[model samples]
Target: MTNFKITLYTDPVCAWCFIGHRTLDQAITLYQRTYPGGRHDMFEFIYHPFYLRNTKPEEGRMTLEDAMLAKNGTEAKVLAIKTKMQRIGTAHGILFNYDSKVGSTKLAHVLIQQAGRHRGAEVQKEMVGAMYSMHFEQGGNINNLDELVAVAVKVGVSEQDAHAWLRDDQVGAEVDELARTAREELGVTSVPTIEIGGLRLEGAEDVGGIMEALVSVKEKEIAVGGAQDPF
Candidate 1:
């Protein structure tokens, strides 16, 4: 029932998702400030969960540095990535620690799926931030139930309920739905793919391109009177 909806498909352990998240938050905040109720009934953010590492499970856990090196990215390349991410993160008031352990993002993404339903879209944002910070900053284990519960509780989810749900797997189907929709339906094989009102963003950190695309989409909507239902 919303006119302007942004679907941000991402993984938990992705450094770029965290980066993109910070950028999107800034852009959205700026959007609201500039156009007040321009987003009236006007906006909804659907967080779509997709794992960037699931394609190679046997690959095991790999840090960003290791992943970079394995992919033939040199020390200079790694430093460049680190610098860019840190600069942007600092600008967005986010402190990112690049050396954090990168674990399986599935459970964390699953927690986000559960949070989307149990909590609302707005609260889901907080849940996402907490989980990302845990992995990227505190270096917590996303695969651990206790750690996940702790993250959820830090973001105001009930500690007891979070623990209970860890065993329940109540939202496993919803998590799978996010993955399937992104891959099969939307043809997204990458992380941080954001689709807003039919506007597509393959990489969240691609700032200039995404901003231009977003403005163009907004103008197109205005030209057509307004956004229509995707349902």
Candidate 2:
């Protein structure tokens, strides 16, 4: 049996990262059902909060509309992409309300890190999912500490602990360091960059493609293991 670690670098505010989350969930489920037994325990997916905006919450942030405009994309282009996302999401039963104002993910990353530390990875994943749902599904601002703390509580994180982590300068610095490491070391300038067993799948990826990548990595691990002679 081989253990595979999948590090998902994502921002809660990214619409496609939300889609990537759903796709990854589906791919994992499909892989388990298709291979059964060993495959289920072989893969472990961990979420790493990536600040795509590279802005601190204390720093004033741009709205979603303004950000797109700054990228030189017209409203029509944005609408077209949203329409496509809606169509694909509907097919997968995932609804994305992109109605919330966009801002930095600094606070959200802090909450995620706290959850992982105090709770566990499973709890952290739930918190991450809730953060995404609040922003993308319910049209809530994840950058708002109140809104974020509510989501954290919903995921079983104590409100007191949540607030403490959010207000702590060390925690905020830790989150910043994570973003720095992802940028400087991992070369991750984009959201939804998934590294599965050292093989990265960046941007939006389809379920089938992600599953194929996972299988390929597993096969490589097996081959490498088989080549070694144990006395």
Expressed as tens digits, the lDDT of each residue in 1-231 for candidate 2 is: 657788999888787898888888888888766743434445666777677775656653455556666665688887777789789878666687656767778888888888888888888889888887888778787678889999988988788988998887898888788888998998998989999878899987999989898677767866878322122
Count the clashes in each prediction.
0, 0
TM-score of candidate 2 on Cα atoms, chains taken together: 0.88
What does each candidate score in C-alpha RMSD?
4.2, 3.5
Residue-level error in angstroms, candidate 1, position 54: 2.3
Residue-level lDDT tens digits of model 1 in 1-231: 135678888888787788888777766656544542434435678888886765432233566567666665688887887788778777766676655556566667777877777888877889898888887777565566677899889888898878766555657666767788888987998978888768777776545565565566676876777754232
User: Deviation in angstroms for 95 in model 1?
Assistant: 2.6
Instruction: Evaluate model 1: give its TM-score.
Output: 0.82
lDDT of 2: 0.78
